[model samples]
Target: MSVASMLKNNKLSKAICEASWATFKAMIAYKAKWYGKQLVVVAKNFPSSQLCSHCGYQNKDVKHLTLREWQCPNCHTRHDRDVNASINIKNEAVWLLTAGTAGLAY
Candidate 1:
């Protein structure tokens, strides 16, 4: 899903709109090209925040913003919401990069 679709009826939509995420993304894209690096944007609906970085578990019950810290039920690992989400996003981007090039001769 795209960011626009994911933002519909979402509280963060207003903040994101005010922040000009489109322009930010554009700038990142331009910088990546200039530096010969790739910018891999995960699908907007990806459950990065709900995913456990330690055990690859998805906690669907964590739907409230108030739940800022959570323990992975599978791994029993504690995680800070923002930190875990950032780790998950990085993992997802690395996976995407590797998967996309897995079939190449080089």
Candidate 2:
């Protein structure tokens, strides 16, 4: 979740502000550089949660945040929203790195 959105929630606003996302990202970049590794940031418009990791099918209905679990219409594979998004992110990162367009190679 983006810090801005998290801060919109009254219960989470304080904790979100305390996290200091800018510093966190800086730290991550520093660590990636120190370890000679690349960091990939998927495009903000990428529909990670809506895409089925198993079949590459985009389910527009999954855009509803309340829908946590869904089945791929093309492949009939069940998925947990967050888990599928993570897999999609990893795949996209690898693809970007291999395509010589790493998002943020530190």
Candidate 3:
């Protein structure tokens, strides 16, 4: 709402994110690179949860209770939040490279 309120909220959100970055990054990065899979870190603004990995469908409805678990309504496939996001990030990197838009979109 107000400038101060916005700043306060931003700082709090950023602090929470910083605390989890290492663990999340390590989990995805290591697993991906371990088997010769490219690891990608998409821009933080990318919407992973809202996109369906199986169908390229996007939705606005998000069930917070299933933050770590979800089934894509369009395809009836279950997804693990972090895992799907990581895969999506990797795809994005490859897509960017092929599209000649970015050397590393991640």
Candidate 4:
């Protein structure tokens, strides 16, 4: 998670500060290194929550946290907010891995 970006919101700033995201990320990095795995860090501002995983449509209306469910206008696919975001994150990581090292070995 991007602590800085999250901290920008007044509602989440305190909770974000208390979450120790830096420590969590450090642990993840350490584990990845120990396991000989490459860690792909996506951009902090990537709109995972707003993007439709099935159709790549950006639903700007889903910006509010209260909207836990949404439908993609482009593909008309119903989506659970968190599920869609996780899928987008996974897709982005896979894309980054392939595009960043197209000719290189893992």
Candidate 5:
């Protein structure tokens, strides 16, 4: 459902809507530093959800949040949307790390 719909239906609250993502990121950064690890922030518009983790095929048609599961047309692989997104994000991070460009802020 849309954020506006959720807010109207009381499924989402105003405080949550006004929360600062930067504060959350700062908290994660501090925690990661304390643990002697790095925190990587991906670009805001990265298409993690639309990418096929198995074959690196990007399905531009998967733009709606309602699509919770989909099949990769390229590889014919069935995927849970969230699981595929997580894998794609992880792979992207790893690629950035290996390519020696992870430190460059987006």
Candidate 6:
């Protein structure tokens, strides 16, 4: 087998991630359209990283994508690659929706 084909066959992680992410986002978008629900894409600059998942502490250091794992200097809490960021983003979305401020915030 050629190297290119070998790489394609062995790249399970990337393929799986791409497939799932695409499907999930598409499902949400299509369903929202079908139901006339508002679907907001939180602005790319919405600070998904700098906000601490645990304390809501905003710091500039957290935005560095190179640091997949890092310690929140303020709280001395270590976080996994995307876990803290995902949690913080989800919480923020819920908060904005529940607070009836999603229209103005996103």
lDDT of 1 by residue, 1-106 (tens): 7778757958778877867877788888888788887788888787998999988999987768899999989999998999999999889888878888422111
lDDT of 5 by residue, 1-106 (tens): 6666766855456655656566677778888888888777677788999999989899987888999999989999998889999998888888888887785322
TM-score of 4: 0.77
lDDT of 4 by residue, 35-84 (tens): 99877887779899999998899999999999999999999999999999
What is the lDDT for 84 in model 1? 92
How well does each candidate superpose onto the true structure, as a TM-score? 0.75, 0.78, 0.55, 0.77, 0.79, 0.59
Error of 6 at 93 (Å): 0.8
- Return the lDDT, model 6, position 35: 88
| Model 3 global lDDT (CA atoms, 0 to 1) | 0.69
Candidate 2 residues lying further than 4 Å off, grouped into runs, are 1-19
Specify the poorest-scoring 10-residue window by lDDT in model 6: 97-106
Candidate 5 least-lDDT 10 residues: 9-18
Q: Model 4's lDDT to the true fold?
A: 0.86
Displacement of the residue 26 alpha carbon in candidate 4, Å: 0.6
| Predicted structure 2, TM vs. truth | 0.78
Name the better of 1 and 5 by lDDT: 1
Residue pairs whose backbone atoms clash in candidate 5: none
**Candidate 3, which segments miss by more than 4 Å at Cα?**
1-41, 63-66, 103-106
Best by TM-score: 5
- Give the C-alpha lDDT of model 5: 0.81
lDDT of 6 by residue, 1-91 (tens): 6545654775665776678777887888788888877665555577777777777777687667887887777787788748987887778
Q: Candidate 2 — number of clashing residue pairs?
A: 0
State which candidate, 2 or 4, has the greater lDDT.
2
